[model samples]
Target: MSEQNKTWCPNIEFNETDEELILKAELPGVKIEDLIINAQTRFVSISGICNPDKSTDEKEVIPSQFNYGQIKCNTPLPVAIQPEKTRAEFIDGVLTISMPKLRVASAVNF
Candidate 1:
């Protein structure tokens, strides 16, 4: 496939729980080394490369539906999170990211 044909962005899902925020991204055929994950206080971003199939011939391809090449997904959090405590894991073509919600300190009246 050509460079223009090989570029696509993956789809991501974001959810929030009582204690943490969760992210799930579809990243089939992507390797851990090719992935980059970035976390901030209120946002998280992920980029990765999905290698194209080398065994298939250009003529043999009928309908192309797969997403290949560099892919990126970014989303802003609904609430502030602790970026330092963020964690990510990739399993079975899915990437899962978990970030702990920041604890708000209450002011005490004198």
Candidate 2:
């Protein structure tokens, strides 16, 4: 399939702490160099490819369980964030992203 033709959505998990929002995505067999992340103040986008296993001998395939293809995940931030300081890490077939929550300014009346 062409690079632009094959696409899929990977599953994701979200967590929030007092300081930041954490996003974890399941991406088995995907390389770090193949990933592209785009973060905004209220949104984040992750895209990559999970290439099919070529090492396994081509037998009469009965059934395939793993979803292998172009994977993409787009998630909305619970609160505004400083996208410039966002951090992403890929380890053990999982992608974790931490986004610092923007602090709200308080108002005072005399």
TM-score (all chains, Cα) for each model: 0.85, 0.87
lDDT of 2 by residue, 1-110 (tens): 54345688778988999999999998887889999999999999998777766667676366556777777778888799889999999999899999999888899899
Q: Spell out the clash pairs found in candidate 1.
A: none
The lDDT of model 1 is 0.84
- Model 1: how far residue 14 lies from native, Å: 1.8
**Candidate 1, residue 53: how far the Cα is off, in Å:** 2.4
The TM-score measured for candidate 2 stands at 0.87
Query: Candidate 2: deviation at residue 97, Å?
Result: 0.1
Error of 2 at 8 (Å): 1.4
lDDT of 2 at 6: 68
Error of 2 at 39 (Å): 0.8
Prediction 1 TM-score vs. true = 0.85
